[model samples]
Target: MTYDTFQPHPDLASLVKCYWTLEVPPAADSQRQRIVPDGCIEMIFTLGDDIKRYTSADEFIIQPRAMILGQTIEPFFIEPTGYVNAFAVRFYPYGFTSFVTASLHSLANKETPLELLFGDTPAAELEQKIIPATDAKERIQIVEEFLFTKLKSEITIDNIVKSTVGALLETNGVAPIKSILKDDPSKRRQLERKFLNQVGISPKQMGRVIRLQTALKMLLNRQSDSLTSIAYESEYYDQAHFNKDFREFTGINPKEFLGHENMELSSIFYAD
Candidate 1:
């Protein structure tokens, strides 16, 4: 398996996190991979064999060749049919909504074909160009061209929500939502409704996912020698707290996640 990520263009840096590519060699027996929430949306294009996304232990649907995977609140499973080569763009929690008119709330936990967002004709042309890209750089260029043209001239993330999300991210999700809104209880509900429309999840949930991401980085990078240290540094109250949250988000405990064979693909992503 090979995974790589590249920084987004400077003008888009605030909205886009990065672009990534993954290549998994064919295997006689396909493996189940668990995907957890990262508080982001993704536009993915598959260039290899089809893959199955499992909604339940015994149920799955073939993933769209070119699609947008909305904010996922819970972990889900997927298995590739054969060799997997794909490219994806990871957007900030509130960034994707800037480019699309559809409600992010409706997109939650769903993978909608590109045609659903862009018109069928334009989406088809974009996918056709992407399907034959020479490499990640070429793929990104193709995608950027499409997005740059689609971006509305006046589109921007809501100022209040944008600043609030920035605070949560800056604190690694430790800043309480209430704390951000303590000055005015009047706008709490209003902000939350807007947050869901754009971010697909409640502010509290985004915070947890962001904190989980911090712990994941520590685990993948071996930044800490012990889970206790990881938990403390990640701002969890205790080791048990860390374990519980990890299992809730990842469907596996910290230790098992560190060296498990099934986590090969996930490890590649987090390590990147």
Candidate 2:
């Protein structure tokens, strides 16, 4: 398995988090991997075998060759049919809305094909370019060019949402939304509404995902000696609170996740 990330261009740094590529050679024994939410949207392009994204233990759909994975609220499972090669753009929590008119909420929890967001002809052309790109750097350039062309002129992110997401990130997802709002009750409703339409989840939900991401990093990086120690450092009330949130987002326990073969790809991502 080979996973790497590249910085986005300076013009898009405020919106795009990074461009990432994942490549796993065909294996005799491929296992299903669980993917958890991190509160950001992603535009992905798969150049290898089709993969199954399981919604439940018994059902799934083929992940699109080119699609946008919206804000996920829970963990999901996926198994590659063979070699898994993909290039994807990771967006900030409030970044994707600057590119399209569709309600971000409409895309939540599913992979919506690129054609559905960008027109068919253009999306098809873009996918062609990405799939045949000579290398990861070329793919990154292709995606950046497409995003630069599609960015909206009139719909910059709301200042309230911007500052709120800024605070959440600055604190590593522990910032309280109410405190970020400065206790302005009148803006609370509006913030939630904008978060749904622009960020694809409520402010609180994004916070939880972000907080969980921090814990995930600790577990992946071997930063602590035990779950109890990690929980305390992550500001969980106790180990149980940390465990409950972990299972809710990742669908697995901490001990089971560490050094597991199936988690290699995700570990590479989070450990970075």
Candidate 3:
């Protein structure tokens, strides 16, 4: 498997972390990989075979070749056919909704087809452009040009969305909804409505996921010896608090997570 990440255009830097492409050789098998939430939305265009998102061993759905995977509240499993070729845009929490006209809440925990948001023709055209690129370098260039030409034209970020993302990043995903809106609890309700429409997960849930991401990286790096230390450093109430949150996000305790083969693949994205 080959994975590469690229810098986005200057104007979109804050909203988009980078464009990325992944390739796996024919007959190679991709283990079930788990991606923890990172307070962002992603737009993926498959250059080859479709990928399946599994809820468990038997339940799953094939994600559209071109789709937006909104802020996930829970971890899911992905199985991609070898020879996987795809490009994706990783958006900051506040960056993606700028392009959406519909309520974001409706997209939460959902793999929304790009056609649903951008119209079928446009979505189809975009996928065709990415999948056939000669190589990874070309794939990145194509996606960057496509996003720059299209999304830059439609980019829009409301004030509420900005502040909500600020609160989440500021507190590292541990901020409470009420605390986030101490200035106006009414804003809290409004944010929740907007989050559901634009973010797919409640603000509170995004915060916790963000916080867990911080701790996850530390564990991967062997930065701490005990769960208690990691918990305190991550701002959880205690070790138990850390364990509960860890299990919630990865479906396993920290000790088990570090040694599991599947966790090895997941650690790449989860790293701080």
Q: Give the lowest summed-lDDT range of ten residues in model 1.
A: 263-272
lDDT tens digits by residue: candidate 1, 127-198: 999998898999889999888888879766788788788998899989987788877889889888888888
* Candidate 2: tens digits of C-alpha lDDT, residues 171-247: 87788887998988898999999989999999988888888888889887889979998888788888888899988
Off by over 4 Å in 1: none
Q: How close is candidate 3 to the true structure, as a TM-score?
A: 0.89
Across 172-260, the per-residue lDDT of candidate 3 in tens digits comes to 77767676677786687778777776666777787888888888888889998888898998899988888998888888888888878
Instruction: Evaluate model 3: give its lDDT.
Output: 0.77
By summed lDDT, the worst window of 10 consecutive residues in model 3 runs over: 149-158
What lDDT does each candidate get?
0.89, 0.89, 0.77
> Looking at model 1, how many pairs of residues clash?
0
Q: For candidate 1, what is the lDDT? A: 0.89
The local lDDT score (0 to 100) that residue 54 gets in candidate 1 is 91
Ranked candidates (TM-score, high to low): 2, 1, 3
User: Clashes in model 2: which pairs?
Assistant: none
Give lDDT: candidate 3, residue 164. 75
